[model samples]
Every structure is written in C-alpha cells, then in structure tokens.
Target: MPINSSLASLSDMAFGTAFVIYLLAMILSVVFYVKAAGEKPEGAQKFIGMTQSLVWLGIIVHLVSVVTRGLATHRFPFGNLYEYIAMITLFAMVVAAIFMQRREFKPLWPWVLVPVLSLLFLGGKNLYADAAPVVPALQSAWLPIHVSVVASGASIGLISGVASLLYLLRRWQPEGKEKGFFGKLAKPLPGAKRLDLVAYRTAIITVPVFGLGIILGAIWAESAWGRPWNWDPKETFSLITWFLYAAYLHARATSGWQNTKAAWINIVALAAMTFNLFFINLVTSGLHSYAGLN
Candidate 1:
C-alpha cells in the first residue's frame, strides 16, 4: 500500500521537531559537562547524571520518531539520504550508550555524544526531505539487511573516531594546573595507548560487518542491475573506505603503526566513509543518485 502524502508530510514534521528536541538536549548536556568541570566533589556527579538523563530522553524520542516514520513509509527508514543519516546517527547513539554502560567508558560520553548530536542536527537540517515510498530498486529484502549492518559498522567507526580525538587531546596535555577546559576534559579520557587499543577494537568489530554488507550489496546489485560492480561513485568510495580501514588493521597488526598514528589512520578511514555517505550522494551523480535530496 502507498503512504498518504499528507501523512508522510506530518511524519516528517514530527521527525524534524524531535530532532530539534534532541539538539537542545545535546546543548544542555554540554552545558552540564562544562559546569561539572568546575563543580565541587559532589556537585559534579549530580551534573553528570542530569546530563546523561537528558541525553537518554533525547534518544528515546528520536527512536520513536524514526520508528514511526519507518512504519508510515512501509519500508526501512534508510531508503534516502535523509533517512540514511537519521538511522546512522541513531545507531551511533545506541552504540555509544551501550558501550558506555557495558565497558564503563563513561568518561568518553561527552566526546561521543556530541558528535552523535551533531549528526542528528545535520540529518534534520541538511538532509531533511519528504519521506517517500521505496523505489523498485530498493524494494528488496536485502535492502534493510545491508543498510542495517553497514549503519552499525558506521556507528562503530564514529565511536572510534571520537576515541581517537580524545586520545589526541589527552596525549598533548600540558603540565601543572593550566590545562584549561580541554586539558580537564582530557583527564578522564583513556590513556593514549588505551585509546589506540579501543579505536582498533572498534574498527576490528566493524570491518568484517562492513565487508559483509558490501558483499551483500554486490549480490543485490547483480540481481537488480545485472552487474555486481557498476563503478558508481558511492560504490567506489565505499570500496575505498573498506580498503583504508583494511590498511589500518594491517598496519597495526604487522607494520607496527600504533598509538597516535593508528588513531590518525582510523580518523581518515572514518572521513572517507563520511564523504561517501554525504558528499558523494549529494554533490556527485550516479546510481546512488537515488540517495539525493528530492
């Protein structure tokens, strides 16, 4: 069945509104983090807890908005650039929350959540478009499977990138009490060596799933477009991203590229993924033009 145009428009409005709410929550969280930095012994804990609560609330609303939009469209909510970004941001938040809770990586929350919030805002402002029904090319079972896995992998990449950034901030801290906001922020971040290990762990978890997603994408392309590799801009960039991360893994395992250097390579790999998802889809034209804003 086709979605009613009017209903789709309303859903978009709700999603956009929810996105704004999430952005506001992120701002509040950041403010609290700043305040906590200057607070006394007990006040800091309360501020952090409040900030975390706000973040959680924002995530809940965001999740509901995305799920409703998906149901209304009668397809996975990743058929277009807008939905793709929203889903990716959602996955990133989920991964961050889970990792923070499970691995006791609470100190990394400020760094990780800020980027997730930024992505949410970007998805709403830059990528927002009317949700439409899926095209014939995207009306395959593999569509959701492929996108979900890839998005999760991208979430891991996001976490790794943030960890790398934190690692850099911590590694360069100055001596004495003149560390400033960034210096204080760096205090709780894992050591440079630990940050490198965490980043590699994230990439290791993501790379194989990303590889599977690409392989499945190729199979789906063969079935739909009659070719497994079309040399599309998106495909090319994705392959490049895969290879970059692959190199990161190889260098770490064999070439002895560890610490800041490995973190830098992970940052580059994540950048390639971001460019493939955002710039290639928006600025360039190709088979993935289907991802462009309407």
Candidate 2:
C-alpha cells in the first residue's frame, strides 16, 4: 500500500516534537539530580516531579508518533533503518519510563534520558524516512514479532548496563558529603551491590526474551530463504552477543568471576549489541541488508 503523505507528515511532526520534549526532559532530569545533591529536599522534590511529568508527556507524544506512522503506512512501519531505529528508541523509552515509576529509579533519570534523547535526535534529524510499505522480506508477520522482542531486550540490556557502569563509577568514587561535582553524581546512585543485582536480574529476564526473538527470526528465515541458519552478518553478531551474555551469566555462578569481571562482560555484551544494531546494519552486507535500507 502507498503511504498517506499528509498523515506521514503529521507523524513526522509528532516525532520531531517528541524529540524536543525528550531533550528538555533530559536537561530537567540533570537539574533535578543536581538539586538532589544539596540539602534542599523540598526543592529537589519539585524538580524531580517536573522531570517525571515531562518524561511521561514525551513518552505519550512519542507513542502517538509511532502509531501515526503505522496508520500512514497501514503496516508496522519498520521496513527501513529509520523506522527500525525509531522503534528501538520508542520501545526503550517505554521500558525506561515504566522502570522510572518506581522511586528507586529516580536518581537514574538523567542517565536514562541521555541515551533516549540522543537516539531520538539522530533518528529524527538524520535518519528520517517517510512512511512506506515493508520490503518483501519484511512483509511476513515474523519480523515485527522478532524485532519487538529483540529491541525490547536490547533496550533493557542497555539501561541495565548503564546502571552497571554507574555502579562501577560509584564504587571507584564512593559517596561523600562533599558538594563537589563527582560527589553530587555519586550521592544519588544506588550502591554497586544493588546496581549489580539489578543489572543481573534484568539480564536474566531479558535474555530469554531475546532468545525467543532469535528463534522467531530463524523461523521467519526458514520460510523466507529456505534455511534457518545461514550465518548472515547480523545473525552471526547476534549469536555472538547472545553467547557473551550467556557467558556473563554462567560466570556469575563461578567463584572468582562474579563481581566487576561479570559486570565488564555485560558491558562488552552491550557493545556487541550496539555494533550489531548499527555496524551490521550499515557497514556489513547480508540477508538483513534490506533492514538497513541499502
């Protein structure tokens, strides 16, 4: 089906507006965190409330943008790299926002908002694509199913990994009463032990979902290409990412590899997923090339 140009334009407008809102929310979150560093608890609460409201508002607008694109195209609206990135960003934001519902995630708003804002900016500014029908390969029902699961896992992993990184930073620089910049940053973050546990549990929950996405992709591949494991660049890198996470989890049960080392492995897994998302799609050639819109 052809795109409705007017609807598509409206969708783009919403997307751009959402990006600005997310950027504003990111700034507000940082201000909120900074205020939290001081002794003014009431003032800090004011900023935090404002930040949370902005984030939720941006999320609602973004959701409408995604849905409007789907309406414009009468499909999932993720045929090309632009839509793919947009979906990933949207799903990530949704998950991050849900986690933020818990007050424990309050201090992590800025950390969460930065990536979401960056992704929305790049997607809107540089990777914008008009609403279009899916490519032949993407016409199957499997791609959206596979992609939603995989993207959700990626988002969960990314945010949890960021928490792990913060865990390390906090460990390297303990919380103190000083009003310095680093001190302020460290004060709000949960301890390394707490962060590590959160990251681990998140990984545990996400890995199976990601694995199921891969399984579905293989099923789709068998139908599309008459084979399930052709070792495409994207597939291969995805497997590598899966294995890294597997090893990280297994190592967690080991005697000596359960602390910072496991956290480091999760970081590497996060990097591998990033490379798969961008490098494999953009720089490499394979069956998934259509996904890059190349």
Candidate 3:
C-alpha cells in the first residue's frame, strides 16, 4: 500500500523545524558555557536551564514528527538514509540528556551535539525522499528492533568520541597552562581524567549493545537475504569499529591504559565508525546502498 504523501511531507517539515530549534539551543548552551568559564555561574545556570527546556521541547517535536512519519509511511522509516540520520540524532540526544542528568559533563553538550543535529537536518533535506512505500523485503518485524538498537549503540559511540576529543585537548596542555584553541577551551572543560572516564564508561556501556546490534543484524540478514555474512564495506568497517572498542575494553580491564591513551583509542574507533557511516555510504556501494542521498 502507498503511504499518505502529504502527511509524510508534513512530518519531515516538522522535524526540520525542530532541528533548527535544537541548533538554537546548542548556541545557547555554548553561550552558557562561555559565561560559566568566566566565573558567572549564576547566569550560566539560567541559560543552561533554558537550553535544557528547549532541548526537551525539541525532543517532543522530533518524537511527534518521527511517530507521524512512521504512521503515515506505515513502515519502520529506517528504509532510507534520511530516516536513519533522524533516528541516529534522536538517539544521541537522548543519551546526552541521560548522561547530563547523572554526570558533571554538561560542559561538553554544545560542542558535541550541535554538529550532529546540524548533520541530521542536512541529511534530511538532501537525502529524504517521498514515502514511496516499502517493498516486501522490509516488511519484517525485526526491522525496527534491529535498526533502533544499532542506532542507539552508534549514539553512545559518538558521545564517547566527543569526550575523548576533549580529553586529548586537555591532556596535551602543560600542567596549569592553557594554549591553542582547544587548550584555551579546555580551561573551562572538565578534568582530563574525568573526561577520559566518561568516554570509557560510554564506550563500555555501548559495547554490549554494539555487539547485540551486529548479531541481530546478522540474524536479520540471514532471514531476509539468506546470508549471515556478506563482507560488505559497511559490514567490514563496522566489525573493525567493534573490534577497536573491544580492544579498548580489554586494555582497560588488563593493562592499565587509562586517561590519554584510552581517549586516543576512542577517537580512532569513532573515526572508523564515522568513515563507515559517511564515506562508505557515499563513496562505496554494497548491500548498504540504501544510504545514498536522494
């Protein structure tokens, strides 16, 4: 059955609007962080509160947009690149919000989130197609579960990468001295060890989910395409990314590779994941060719 074309477009427009609002919230967050760095904690807290409220508002709007799109399309909406980016960004926001609630890592929100939110909007604008409807191959019930889990794991990996970047920027500076763009920025950032631990925790929690996503993906592939392993570019890169994190986990558990070195590994793993997600989709062709811009 064909989807409701008008409704699908409306949902996309709504999501775009929400994404713009999210970008604005990120700007406010940056302002707050800058002010806080200058010792104006009161004003910073107010702005941060306002930013948080706006983030929640954006979340609600995005949720409505995605749910409506799924309903209108009458499919899982993970069939194309635009929808996948939307879902991935949403998952990242959720993870960030959760971490902010528990950790003192709120300072990293703007630098980490704004780029992702912007990319999601760009992807939606350039990659989204009309709800052309899904084929029989995508009608399986496992589609949503598999895609959602994988997206969640990717979100955690992204946040871990951001934290690792911040750690490196801080660690490279001389003790009690700040230099360079990142070094100047690091004055207000959390301690290097703290940032590394945050990255470590995020990666550790995500490893199991990442493993599950790959396993479930293999199961789905076997069911849908009659093969459990295809050695596609995306698949190969994803396995590499998985192994990178697995090594990190093992090093943390055995060799005392804490702090800067662990952070560097996180950055490397994230780079691989980013290559798999963006470069592989654009420059390479494979079973994952559905990721092309429309």
The lDDT per prediction is 0.74, 0.79, 0.79
Pairs clashing in candidate 2? none
| Model 2 lDDT per residue over 55-158, tens place | 88888888888888889988876678777777878877877777777776788888888877777776766666667777777888886788888887787888
Over 4 Å off, model 3: 39-42, 174-176, 292-294
Sorting all predicted structures by TM-score, with the top scorer first, yields 2, 3, 1
Q: Please give, for residues 1-294, the per-residue lDDT of candidate 3 as tens digits.
A: 678878887887888888877988898888888887664566777778778888878878887778878888888878777788888887888788777764367778787767687667678767766666654666788889888888889988988888888888878764368776655577667777887788889999779998899989899889888999899888888889998987777766666666566666778898898788788887898886776354
> lDDT, candidate 3, residue 244?
90
Best by TM-score: 2
- Per-residue lDDT of model 1, residues 47-164, tens digit only: 4565566667767777877777787788878888778777888778777777666333655666776677677677777777776777777889988988888888888888877777
How far is 231's C-alpha from truth in model 1 (Å)? 1.5
Clashes of 1: 0
Clashing pairs in 1: none
- The lDDT, on a scale of 0 to 1, for candidate 2 is 0.79
